[model samples]
Target: MKAASYDAYAPDNSRLRVGDVPDPRVGPGQVLVEVRAAGVNPVDWKVMAGGLDPIVEAVFPVIPGWDVAGVVAAVGVDTPEFEPGDEVISYARMPIIRHGTFAELVAVPAEFLARRPVALDWAAAGGLPLTGLTALRLLNRLEVTAGDVLLVYGAAGGVGSIAVQLGRERGARVIGTASPRNHDFVRGLGAEPVAYGEGQADRVRDLAPGGVTAVADCVGGQLDTTLAVLAFGGRHASIADPSVTEHGGSSVWTRPDGAALTELAALADQGVLTVEVSRTFPLEEVAAAFDASRTGHTRGKIILTP
Candidate 1:
């Protein structure tokens, strides 16, 4: 099979290249998926540059991608949850980096697989898992409720955009921070938009005079800003900043859960959630996809069509 792979970590993505690789071997409780599309995330390039080295051990000639949407081609022993031809989406992060979804095929543990939402196309389904999981986990940690006023920093990025919509679904009044150009885009996702940076706290205070009931910081480096506008005793969580723990907020890290993904899929099917794909690249163009994601300006997801 042809896959985009690298033998060593390179910050400039100089080692990432497409070439033929052996097919993955399905293990017990796993399924082999024919990759239709994969999502490119910041972690993909970060992993390439050894940013996750302490946490994820990388095997040489690593195929680097975790978000995948595809059809099940075969199932391993004892994997009864899915069968051939079933469409699935998975946050296929392994404890170690080795076989990945950027390839033409990948072997995924059944525990990480969820049926793709009927309403989503291939690229959108591929893009939904990681960001959706991040947003869902953050909201869950914050314990956002219908009556809460939730403020989201970096509201136009992948996780933040989804968080905005999910907050609205839970009946929270959401105020999202984005650049002026993206305010309309964020508003369309059901949040009142506020421009990020200088005086952001004041803008948020104007909208929620008493302060917001919860905060989800998808963008890092805003811990002080978050504290300034948070209601007394309100909950807050950050995906990017671990310093949140020192400020009475939790640092959220998403875990792969088939059940949670299923629920998110149902929301998509019900028209309560949607994924925006900002760009699509062929598998061979994975480098370019990473470049685009590094720009940090994309409003949604960058997809790689395999």
Candidate 2:
């Protein structure tokens, strides 16, 4: 099998390369997926750069990716939930970084695999798992509900865009912050668009005079801004910053849950949720894909087709 791998932690990605590797082993309660597509996220490069080393230890010749959409090639012992030929999507992040989805095949635990939404194509499904799970977890952590006004920072990006839509589906009035060029794009996701920097809190206040009932910070470095516009006793969560907990907000980290992914998939099938894939690269072009994600300007998800 061919995979993108790095033998050492190199922030500049100098050691990252695509080459032939042995096929992944299907352990008990796991399934080997014939990789169709994979999602390129910030964490992919971050892991390669050793940014997550304090938490997730890396082994040499590590394959680096977490999001995948693929077909089950073989099922391991006791894994009765799925069989060969089943289409699935998974946030396949493991406790250690030895194997990942940026390869021709990946072994995913059955507990992490969910049926891919039929409404989404390969690239979209590949991109949906991690970002979708993050947005869902953040909204759940904030306890967003009907009649509440929810404000989302970085609303045009992957997690934020999905968060905006999910907020609207939950009957919350969502106001999303993005650049001027993406205002309409955010609006299309059912959020009232506000420009991100400078006086963003004021703009949010104008939209919801009582202040926002909940805040979801997908982008970091905005805790003060989030506090300024939050209604009294309101809840907030951040995926980017841990310091949010000091301000009475929760720092959310997405976990792999097949059940939650199943619900999200149903929402997509019902037309209540959609994934926007900004660009896609072939597996061999993983480096270019990482470069694009590093730009931090893409309006939606970037995908790697295997």
Candidate 3:
């Protein structure tokens, strides 16, 4: 299998190396996927760089992606929801516990797999699970609804972009923080864009004269930077650094929820949700991808086309 993996905690040693390995044997309740694409998340690089020291004990040098899309190569008998050749996307729980979708094949429990929208190919579909679930959970946790004013930090990036669209779908008055280059893109998603950095709080306040009712931080450094703009008692959720919570609004961390992924898949298929791919790389170029992630600036999610 052409897999991207490295020695434990040696992110720099990680490379796109080709080695022939025995194929996986499917167990009951599992489905085998001829992996097509894998979503790249910051956590993938963190796993390599040893930056997540607090949770290092629980982490592994495993293949680093959680979101995946592929065709079902096989299915267990007890799972009647799918069959051979079913195109699907999933946040693989078991493989994440061992290997991951950064290989030519991966096996996930049947329940985690959802049929991919015929409208989306592997790259777009693979990008959906992790960020999609994070966006969905954060918006739901903040209880954003119609007429509520919400401010999204990093609104032009992966999770932020999706949250902005979801917030609009839920009827929130959406304001987003992004670079000048992405102002139009975020606006296209229905968010009023506020430039991030000096005077950012002022810009947010200017956007919401009444006050920002809720905040979601997909960007790490923008929270303390936006403190003064949040309405008193406004909720906050973050998928990045929790230091943003110190600014007095709440913070959030993401977890993989199969059910939530299902909901996101449904929304995507219904044309109510979409995933943006800023760039795509083959499995061998993972080091360069991690370097890109370290820069902290990209238009959308980076994808690994396996």
Model 1 error, position 34 (Å): 0.7
Point out where model 1 deviates above 4 Å: none
lDDT value, candidate 1, whole model: 0.94
Question: Considering lDDT, which of the candidate structures 1 and 3 is the better prediction for this target?
Answer: 1
lDDT of 2 by residue, 108-149 (tens): 999998999999999999999999999999999988899989
Residue range 70-128, candidate 3, lDDT tens digits: 99999866878788988988877452344678888887888777788766778999888
The TM-scores of all predictions, comma-separated, are 0.99, 0.99, 0.91
> Which runs of model 3 end up more than 4 angstroms from their true locations?
11-18, 52-61, 93-97, 243-249
Q: What is the C-alpha RMSD of each candidate to the true structure, in Å?
A: 0.8, 0.7, 2.3
- lDDT by residue (188-232, candidate 1, tens digit) is 999999998799899999999999999999989998888899999
Model 2 spans > 4 angstroms off: none
Model 3 steric clash pairs: 238-252
RMSD (Cα, Å) of candidate 1?
0.8
Worst lDDT 10-window in candidate 3: 53-62
lDDT of each candidate versus the true structure: 0.94, 0.94, 0.78
